[model samples]
Target: MTLPQALQYLGTAVFAVSAVLAAGRKGLDLLGVLVIALITATGGGTVRDLLLDRTPFWFTDTGYVVTILLSGCATVVLLRWRHPSERVLQIADALGLALFSISGARIAEAAGLPGLIVVVLATITGTFGGVLRDVMCNDIPLLLRPGTIYGTAVIAGATLYVLLQSVGVPRDTAAYAGMVVIAGLRLAAIARNISLPALTIRDTDAD
Candidate 1:
């Protein structure tokens, strides 16, 4: 399989694992778990495809569905025996974000899109699935949450990918570099409790 295809499968599996963990926290049943997993794994790609006027990746390939089902079921079975920590869920999410972000940027670049649009689509493809998962879980989407470094990490990764290519870096190497930058920044933020400063607004009516 091509590297992009492999990254898509791996990213889907990682997102499925995170979905299982998130759904487990909410006491979802097996069916609900599967549903959440499906959404978390494919939601971003679906949106990306719709915007690009292309068929959704899962629609074109059965492998995507099979990977999600197998990964979700296995995670469910394993975690049924032992519950996972929230940190583990976050780590899986970070990995998925990295993989999908880089792959998405590459896809846009291959389509001859400009750098800015590539980054925008990459961020959407990386974070939108998690957004859908959070919405279904009745939590504020991570990307929309104040002080979260999630979208920033994705944008940085995608931008780095574009810059590397501009400097004539090899495609595969640039892709891996982008993934490392994304996952590293995210995981570091988690480990160090790093966060963006929250936005504040003051009322002017009184003045």
Candidate 2:
């Protein structure tokens, strides 16, 4: 498989495993866990395909479904032996985000989209799945969390991919570089407890 295709499969598996782990935290049954895992694995790419007026990728490739199912089941079995910490979930999620962000940007660029749209689509493809998963789990979506750098990391990676392409960097090299940046930024933030300043609204006294 080409690098982008391989990354897409890897991203899907990582997302599925992470979702399975999260469902365990929620005490979900196997069926519920698989459902969440499937959604988390494919939601972002499905949305991106719709926006691009293409067939949803998983619809075309049964491999994605198989990958999600196998990864989810494997994670369920692994969890039976060793419980995962939230930090583990975060790390898996960061890697999946990095993979999907660059892959999405590459897809958009191949479609002849503008740089802005490529970056936007990349961010959506990186984060929307997690958003859906979190909403289903009754947790605030990481992208919506004011202090998190989740979305920013995706955007930064997507922008870098676009810039590198503009400068005539090879597509594969740019994609790998973008993935590294996204994963590095996210992992660093998680390790350092780094966060964007939260915006607050305050009422002023009427004078």
Candidate 3:
């Protein structure tokens, strides 16, 4: 597989695993977990393709579906036998977000979109799957939550990818660099408990 394809598979696997874990946390059955995993693995890419007027990649490539299925099944089996730590899931999720964001930007650029549009599309492609998964599970979407740095990491990666490409860097190298930056930043944020400032509500004085 090419670098972009490889990154896509990696991202899909990571998201599938995360979806299985999330579903399991809610006491979902195997079928429910598998369904969520599949959706989480491909929902963003499907949306991206639809918006770009292209056929969904997963629908065209059976390997993508197979990869997610295997990953989700393996995750369920592993979790059933031995529970994985939350840290492991978090790290995997960060890496997946980085890979998806970089690949999304590259795909948008290849489709001849402007840099700003590429970044926005890339962010959507990176995070929307998780958003859907969260909503399905009745939790606040990570992208919209105060404690989550998910969407911020995606935006950073997409912006960096666009900048590097504009500067004439090779596409693969630029994408890889952007992915590394995003994953690193996400991991750091998790480790240090970095969070956006919370909205504060103030009581009005008597008028």
Candidate 4:
């Protein structure tokens, strides 16, 4: 496979692992874990493909689905035997987000999409799967959470990709750089508990 495609597969595996961890934490059974894992692994790419009017990658190539399923099963078995620390899972999630965000933007750009659309589509492709997984697990989606910074990180990466591309950087190198920046930001945010300012409203007329 090409470098970009390889990165996409790696990202898919990471996200599948995250989903397995989430499902386990929620006390889901094996089947439930597999279901969430599949959704979390492919949901974002599926949406991206639909928006781009292209065949879903998983449908076109069985490798993606096989990787997710095998990884999901392995995760369940491993977690059932012994659970890993929360920090490890968070690290994996951040890496997955970064990789997926860059890959998504690169794919959109390759398809000749505008910069603005590429950025938006990249964010969607990076976060939509997690949102679906969270919803199915009955937790508030991380993208909408006040302190997550998930979507923000994705947007930042996508923006960087566009900027680098506009400057005539090679696509593969630019994508790698964007992913590194995104992953760094996410890890820093987690370590520092960094978050965006929240909008607060007060009722002046309240008695």
CA-lDDT, candidates in order: 0.89, 0.89, 0.86, 0.87
Candidate 4 deviant stretches above 4 angstroms = 1-3, 203-207
- Candidate 2's C-alpha runs over 4 A off are 1-3, 85-89, 203-207
Q: List ranges where model 3 is wrong by over 4 Å.
A: 201-207
lDDT (10s digit) by residue, model 4, range 1-207: 897678778888889998888888888888898899999989988899999998998987899989998999887778657887878878888888998777788789889989999999999889999999998888899998988678998898889889987999987788888888889889999999999987787878958
Q: After superposition, how far is residue 11 of candidate 4 from its true place, in Å?
A: 1.6
Per-residue alpha-carbon lDDT of candidate 2 for residues 23-103, written as tens digits (9 for 90 to 100): 888989999999999998999988999999989999878999999999899988887788778787788788889988887
Candidate 3 residue 63 Cα shift, in angstroms, is 1.1
TM-scores, in order shown?
0.90, 0.91, 0.91, 0.91
| Tens-place lDDT digits, model 3, residues 15-94 | 99988888888998889999999889898888899999999988778998999999888887787589888898889889
* Model 4 lDDT, full chain set: 0.87
Q: How large is the C-alpha RMSD of every model relative to the true structure?
A: 2.3, 2.5, 2.5, 2.3
TM-score of 2: 0.91
Backbone clashes in model 3, listed as residue pairs: none
Taking the tens digit of each residue's C-alpha lDDT, what string does model 1 give over 74-184?
Answer: 998897588777787788778889999888888788888999999999998998988999999999998988767899999998999999989999988988899999999
